[model samples]
Target chain A: AQSVTQPDIHITVSEGASLELRCNYSYGATPYLFWYVQSPGQGLQLLLKYFSGDTLVQGIKGFEAEFKRSQSSFNLRKPSVHWSDAAEYFCAVGVFGNKLVFGAGTILRVKS
Target chain B: EAGVTQFPSHSVIEKGQTVTLRCDPISGHDNLYWYRRVMGKEIKFLLHFVKESKQDESGMPNNRFLAERTGGTYSTLKVQPAELEDSGVYFCASSQTGLGSSYEQYFGPGTRLTVT
Candidate 1:
C-alpha cells in the first residue's frame, strides 16, 4: 500500500544546532511528497512540497527538503534550529488531486 | 483569502449519538477533503470532494459517515450513531482543484470529537 514512514518519533536539538528528520515512502508510481508542521493546538501548515523537477525544495521559516527518487526518501532539514521551531512534523505522499497519506509524525523538542 | 474553516472546535457526545461537522473551504477553491487522526495514529484520508461531487470516498470508514457539499460551497459531514472508536480529531482541507499534480491542501484547525 501507499504509505509514509517517519523513523523518528521524537528528536531533541539544541538551539542554534542543525536538525534533520528522516522520511521514507512506499508507492507504486511517482508520488507527490510534502512536509507539514503542526504546532500545539494548531492546524497543519504546509512546509514544502516536491512534485517534479528540482529535487531540492525550499519552504517558509527557513526550512528545506530534498526528494530522492532512488531512495524513496524526502528528508526535512534545517541549518539552524530555534526555540520556536519546535513542533510536530509530518511527511505525506499522494497522487494528484487525491487525499494525502501521512506518516506517524516526528516531534522536535528544542533545548536551550 | 481566508483559509479553510471548520465549525465546533470541540464536540463531546455519547456513544450512538449523531454529530455533524461543517467545513468552509477557501473562497475560490473547488476541491475539498476530509481527514481524521486517532490518538497515536497517522492522519488518514477519509474522502475527497470535487466541487459538489464526491470524487473519491474510498477511505471512508463506513456507511454511517455521510458527507455532502451543496452548491459547491460549504460542506457537511454527518456521522450517525457515532461509536467510541470515532473519538479523534477530524480535519477539513481544500485545494484550488484536483487536477494535475497541484494537490496542495490548506487545512483547518480541526474539530476534536469525543464519544464517551
Candidate 2:
C-alpha cells in the first residue's frame, strides 16, 4: 500500500514571499508523484508530476517540485507567492496504473 | 477543449434516501475514475471504469455504492440508503490511453452531496 503525508494543514505567507509545501510518501518502490491545486468551488488541477526524470520538475503557474529519492519527499515550491495562489494543495502518489493515494492536503493563505 | 463535467453541482438528501451522481468524462477519454473527499479527510478513490467495463473497484467503500457506465460515455454512481458519513464532495476524473509520463487526470468540479 502507498500513502502520502502532508505535514502542514495550513500555511500563511505574504505576497511575493517564497513558499514551500512539504510532502512525504511511503511506497515500496519509486512511485509516481503529483501536485494538485484546488481553488474555491473548483476542481483539482495538476500542478506537476514526477515519474522518472530530472529531480526538479516545473509546472504551470510558476510552481515546481523536487523529487528526493533518498528522503522519499516531493515538496512543492514557488519563488514568489501571489494573492491568487491561495488555495488547497494536495500531494498524491500513484501505484502502478492503479488508484492514487492522496495526502490530507494543505490550505495556503496568501496575505497581502 | 471542455473538461470533465458532473451533474447537479450540489445535492441535498436525507439519510436513507438515494442519490445518483453523474459524470461525463472528456471526449475520447477511455479511463474514468470516481473519488470522494469527506470533511477533513484526504480524497479517496472509489472506482475506475475503462470504457464500459470496470477495471478496478477495490476502493469502493461498501456494496451499497453502485457505479455503472453504459455505452462507454457517461457514468453514474448511485448510493442507496445513504448515510450521514456519506456527506462529501464526489469528484470524477478522466484520462486518455497511453498517458505516459504525463499521466495527468482531468477533473470535474465535483458534486457536493449533503446527507442530513
Candidate 3:
C-alpha cells in the first residue's frame, strides 16, 4: 500500500513570506505525487502533480512542487504566499490509476 | 464551464438513518470519483465511475454503502443505517478522460454529512 506523510500539522507565517510544505511517500515503484488545497467547507483543488520526466512541477496559484526520488519527498513551495494562500494543504500518492492515499493535511495560517 | 456539482450541501441524520448523496459531473466528462474526509483524517477514495460502469470500487468500505452512476452522467452514494463514523465531507470530482495524465479532476463543493 502506498502512503503519504506530511510532517507539519499546522504552520503560521507572515503574509508575503516564502513557504514550503513537506510531503514524503512510501511506494515500491515510481510514485505519482500531487498537492491539493482546501478551504473551510469546500472541496479540494489540485495544486500540482508530478508523474514523470521533470522533477520540478509547477501548478496553479503560483504554487510549485519538486519530486525528489532519493528522499521520497515531493515538497510544495511558494516564494511569496498571499493571505489567500491560507488553507489546508494535502499531499497524496496515486497508483494503478484508481485510488489515492492522502497525507494528514497541513493547515497554513497567514498572518498580516 | 461549471465544475462538478453535488446536491444537498449539508445533511444531518440520526444514527441508523439512511442518506444518499448525489453528484452531477461535468458534461462530456467520462471519469467521476467519490471521496470522503472523516474528522481529523485525510480524504479517502470511496469509488470510481467510468460512465455508468464501476471501474474500481476497491476503496468502498462496506456493504452498507452503495454507489451508482446510471446513464453515466451523475453518480450517487447511499449509506444505510449510517454510523457516527460516516460523518464527514463527501466530495465528488470529474475529469474529461481517465486514461491519461491530462485527466485533472475538478471538484465540487462537498456535501457535509453529519450523523448525529
Task: Kindly list the per-residue Cα lDDT of model 2 for residues B1-116, writing each as its tens digit.
Answer: 88999998999999999999999999999899999999999999999898999999988999889999999999999999899999999999998887453256888999999999
| TM values, all candidates | 0.97, 0.97, 0.95
Candidate 3 structure quality by residue, lDDT tens digits, B1-116: 87889999999999999999999998898889999989899888888888899988887889999999989999999999899989999999888774444246778999999999
Clashing pairs in model 3, backbone N/Cα/C closer than 3 A: none
lDDT of 1 by residue, B1-116 (tens): 79999999999999999999999999888889999999999999999988899999988899999999999999999999999999899999998753543378889999999999
> Any runs in candidate 3 off by more than 4 Å, and if so which?
none
DockQ of 3: 0.60
What is the per-residue lDDT of model 3 for residues A1-112, given as tens digits with 9 covering 90 to 100? 7889999999999999999999999999878788999987777898998888989999999999999999999999999999999899999887676567889999999999
Model 2: residues with Cα > 4 Å off, grouped in runs? B99-102
Estimate, for each residue in A52-91, the C-alpha lDDT of model 1 and write its tens digit.
8999999999999999999999999999999999999999
Query: Candidates ranked by lDDT, best first?
Result: 2, 1, 3
DockQ, 0 to 1 scale, candidate 1: 0.74
